[model samples]
Target: MSEQSNPIRSAIAEAIADNPTILFMKGTPEQPACGFSARTVAALQALGAPFAAVDILPDPRIRQELSEISNWPTIPQLFVKGELVGGCDIITEMYESGELAEVLGVEEATKASDPNVAPEGQPVQAAPLGIENRLR
Candidate 1:
């Protein structure tokens, strides 16, 4: 059957179009339910960029539909400007290389560089977001 007939596909498409920067992750940005998701969230947070996130945990169909539509067999999928940027590894690499900030149209902030804070730097840490395996 064509994907157009699937409501989940439509929802995923709508979400990507609606949000300039969105993540189809395992959980919310405040509490990602996976190590990959947490890392991805942290990378984005470090960039100080805003993003919308959808948790695929409530329904297995969401992840299935997302994979079918994105043609990417992974959660923590990132979309920027309605384009799939990839998952955790890609996001981390992009963050380290400053490509993520460029994609998000934000200035890259240096670690421990906030002038308002003391000389001792406070690292931007990903919240203690738990990790859940969906591949099983």
Candidate 2:
């Protein structure tokens, strides 16, 4: 079977269909293809749990298809159990705070930079408004 037609494709789709948290990235967790991808991967690693990673580089179709599925035009889009979480910028912001781990049901990563506060002398964290509570 072709890579696009492989059962693993559907299996990966189904696996992420209801996952609580997943990141569709350009490379594996161990090796990321871009800086944004790297940041997100590092954040996931900090969560210290097994999460799904889909390399969009292998197939051209998946990029289009995933965009259709999530309506997200970016690679590295995060899905919290089949639900669209956000893009890299949003995920990074959430990671700097303690929210991403809470939503993903994983322990927060140890950070040299505190999510409770910003490094550049920012005051109290602004409440994250658009972050939806998990559906599954």
Candidate 3:
């Protein structure tokens, strides 16, 4: 089915457009199901960026539709301002280089300079708004 005709695709696209920053990952930010997702979540948390997270695990179609929409065959996809910011490796690299903060439009948390450690504080959780599962 064409993207315009698919409800899942429409929902996924809407979710991306509606949320300024969103991560479609294997699990929730608090309990990421994969190492890549964990690392990605950590990077965003460390940067103190509030984003919306959608767990793609509840339904396989979520992942399939997300990947199709993103054109990125990866579980942990980060979208900033309705654009794909890439997966774990890209995020990690950007974090270490401080580019992620620039992309996220937040100050680079001092602790985030070290990829091994998260910022010292209660890691900012994903924002509640626009965080729905986006699946029927």
TM-score of each: 0.78, 0.69, 0.83
Better by lDDT, candidate 2 or 1: 1
For model 2, state the Cα shift of residue 4 in Å: 12
User: 90-133, model 2: which lDDT tens digit per residue?
Assistant: 88888777788787786664444433222332221121221111
TM-score of decoy 2: 0.69
lDDT minimum window of 10 residues, candidate 2:
127-136
Rank by lDDT (best first): 3, 1, 2
Q: After aligning candidate 2 to the native by TM-score, how far in Å is the CA of 53 from where it should be?
A: 0.9
RMSD (Å) of each candidate, 1 decimal: 7.4, 11.2, 2.8
List of clashing residue pairs for candidate 3:
none
Ranking by TM-score: 3, 1, 2
Instruction: Tell me model 1's lDDT, rounded to 2 decimals.
Output: 0.72
Residue-level error in angstroms, candidate 1, position 70: 0.8
Error of 1 at 26 (Å): 0.6
